[model samples]
Target: MSVQTFKPSVRVGNWNEDISLDEDLLKDFLEKREKGELLLQKSGRLKKCILQKVELSFSKDGFLHFGDVIMLLNPENSEESLSNPSPIYGNYTVSVNPDESALSSKTQLTAPCGISGISNVKPCARNVFIITSVDGSDYGEPLHYGQNFALRTRDGFMGHLYLTSDQKTFLKCCKKSHLQEVSLTDQPSYETCWQFVYLDPQLRMENEGVPVPANTKLLIVHSKTNRCLAVLRKYILWTFFGKECEVTAHTYLNGHKAEENENHWIIVTGNPSDDINTMFDRPKPPSEEMNENKCIVKPLQK
Candidate 1:
């Protein structure tokens, strides 16, 4: 496979405010330097300055370096810029444009050009499962997999979810092995792997020692992108009821949060009958069966 390269525009700003290095600010800073004024404030100081345009690059080290200063790119907080007091001494939002190349490369385990074996690669699991809504009235449309991965409340069947090896992209009803030439197996060659990441720290603390409810709202993160999965709802005539619903990965913290609906999605799980053994398969124990129920999918509560 060819290594993909991404060059996203990076912006820095205050965490709690919409402050960033605007053209006016940059120009003002230049004027101050020409006047021989001090750049450092008593509390907050301008640590570094950029003069001419320089080539910016990102690596697997998770830091965007320009000259002597470095910005920490925390995967846990993938959507926002973090505060690094040593280099840049304040809260800054280091925003990266969510282009395909940049997104695919960032989520990979190694550099795009590095020689990482397949095992080291984090590919989306290929599994056929149902995305059941929490209200128990609707399901994702399997037939619409090629179109938008639409979901509806009535007359919809189970849709198979698949993830690419990079884990940043998603596909429907496709096997990773089929996407790449590999061996065959009686078991599913691909699986849809997902998890609920807590959005509120206080909510997490409050629910400590208590089992999380099935209806809890979470950011469904794909293992590869470390970003949230969101459904893009638009009008479509081919859907179960002529309404189109599509799923896409989003980086809302990067100032694009308002562009996408972060409030959607509840949980994803297998069909209710997934635990029962078929004629060709052996029955799993209750404990094992319960583990399969973790795929929770539902609409966000109003």
Candidate 2:
């Protein structure tokens, strides 16, 4: 039963006890009772947090400013948001898994939301990021086209965006995440630097030092490899964030040239306290996306 369903034997106004209960003790008991069945949410626990969903327009200066707490919205064409056989169920206690990658996490069963929608699940660290320079500079600067910058996770996970160069083929997918971990703050590495390729060459819209707009679609290229950031749906992994398309930096050679790859992404940002949410609507299956299926827990697709 939920704590809200419980009631004290003594009524709120009709209390007739001769020996009164200690106020402090009463408060402690109630607090513990509330937390007893709590399911910890890293992003949800934020004393203040904003959940930003995708939209064609934005309320912030349409142009994105540096040092913004941002989240990258994967392209819908990537099929990254499609729900698979398994879907996130009700309330869960997310826990760290020692066997998985040190940065990896998993969801432990706790409460059931009773709803069949993936929308109800709490977001993982994957949904939060920050845009900063390799050094501590550029906090309030506007981002320019094709300029070098570092993207870092903002949810306290603390990983920098970087290219994974240790693969067999130089052109591998980017798990470095939105190019993701390693601290540029400690020492700048070329692997973590990335450049934004404008969507249209004709307009050269923001090339001349204009800030990239929020909710604007553009390509993310790793500085070292020139490989664009992409999500390989075929490379889905069951992560702490549920089944998600694997992040990679590469241009496929199937038909078109490297530049033809679908690597467009949107950066959304805002402060939760300002009524702007850090939580955006995650991709959900078209049909009934409920806890009907079990979670496919794995570190990576491979």
Candidate 3:
């Protein structure tokens, strides 16, 4: 039996538009050059190229920006307000680095700060929150093994966490660990820096809402390993009942979703007298007194 392959039809309308590939366009340009319709360099290098801009009446859901032009594919019903959306209107720039030898290009998209759609956002450093696991342990100090070190949170020390110089990475006070024992230091160092980011915005929005609070159902991400800081529930049970449960409340460096309960954290800052539990609900707006750099880390109340 012979099988027939299906070919999708391209429909150009108010919502849809088709764009020609560079290869096809170049091929046509070369053909035109042979006919003396277009000029080419003496070395046959196509240095100067002009592409006709394609227009769309409505902006699609997954529209992509190439330089100043916005490319829409399988557009949705909704349309964008402006002809060219700037970074202020959630439109950002995409950079493409092409390698002639490799015949490949590396592309990167970047959005301005405070935009919701971008994932590479540097966390607001004005108020640094010392994240503590639900089990009452702070992400300890940095311990050097060789040339590099790891960030570990130990119980009983104030983990004053802050964004690194890059603003995308997290760092805390440094401490030296020998064998299984840990020792604290008075100063902070770059060795304690960590790459931490928020969980998927969609998932976070489903669980909570926009303008996510520090104490809500959120995941503290470890950027380098793509692991999450989770609590081991068994540890809590073992601590209280001496039931010999495994230590489950620890930073998850591997991609595992075993401990969800222990993963939640409470971010505390500001006045020492204020109730930590109510801090998330009644968050003090950024004011003169409660400036961004002046944050106080406190332990979670039992």
Candidate 4:
């Protein structure tokens, strides 16, 4: 039996208004690539070419700048997203094997909403898709190649990704996110500064004998309520690793030590503070002696 062939669409924001991968668009993209408009890695086991990286600007000039972890694309041939067998009633999830390559390299995929009907999206130009290497005999496709990565069509609009490696990708997909383009001259946006929170296991353990180490960085912001804290953790795990990543909670800040886990990233305090609370709290007022001869703390608490 012949496998079904589907022509991929390159619509700006939808599949229906598809534009054929004409010469003009490819020419423009190639010119931009050579102009250093995109990050280009010269060496790596995986072919390195960043289509785009999340960037923020703090300058008044209106120019933009991107952060690290250049968005690189896989160089493999086209592949399809995993299809579930027993489509009517089945239980399954995408399970990635834990290994260096899978962990080191990741991609995130997003699809347009309001599906008119069942569909298959072809690869976009230079973009990659994640797919199972094996086929399912029962499901009409061969079974048992297991999960793997493959490149999207070179000129297709960004479609579903195989793995995602950063928070920026999640923000792009979340509709409720209050995304705003800050003026270049205004306070630098989240894109400009590296976000890191100091974890001090000793402090947390001092309050409670929990062994959570404070040496690691926790990027997800915590809250006063347990619900919020749990949500933060859940969000972090889902945002980057999803079900594929293994996440551990730390009690202290120790980014310097994790330098070896280059694949791992951290968020820590940017300014100086004796304690994490003070780092997060407002500045303290100066201490002074009152005319009544008693020591007084300025800005008395209400």
Most TM-score-accurate candidate: 2
* TM-scores for every predicted model: 0.26, 0.50, 0.24, 0.17
Best by lDDT: 2
lDDT of 4 by residue, 1-302 (tens): 99756645333454443344455688877886675443332212123222332121112221111111111111111121134332211111111222232223324212221110011111111222122121121221211111111212111222322221113243433222212111111122222222122233234324232211111222222111111000111121131122321222122223644211111221111113333221112243555433211124465668
Models, CA RMSD each: 26.4, 15.9, 25.8, 25.1
Ranking by lDDT: 2, 1, 3, 4
Compose the digit string of candidate 1's lDDT tens values, residues 1-302: 97646332342336323444465688888887675453243111111111111221112232111111111111122222243223211111111111122112212211111000111011112111123322222332111111111111111111121222233324421122211111111122222233345555334445433322332234445444445554322211131112222334443563533312232332222122444211112243444332112233444468
Candidates 2 and 4 compared by TM-score, better number: 2
- Tell me which of candidates 1 and 2 scores higher on lDDT: 2
Cα-based RMSD of candidate 2: 15.9
The number of clashing residue pairs in model 1 is: 15
Candidate 1 vs candidate 3, TM-score winner: 1
Q: What would the TM-score be for candidate 3 when compared with the true structure? A: 0.24
Error of 1 at 48 (Å): 65
Which 10 consecutive residues of model 1 have the lowest summed lDDT?
114-123
Comparing 1 and 4 by TM-score, which wins?
A: 1
Superposition-based RMSD of candidate 4 using all C-alpha atoms, in angstroms: 25.1
Each model's lDDT comes to 0.26, 0.45, 0.26, 0.22
lDDT of 2 by residue, 186-225 (tens): 2346766877777655445546455676655667777777
Shift of residue 169 alpha carbon in model 3, Å: 23
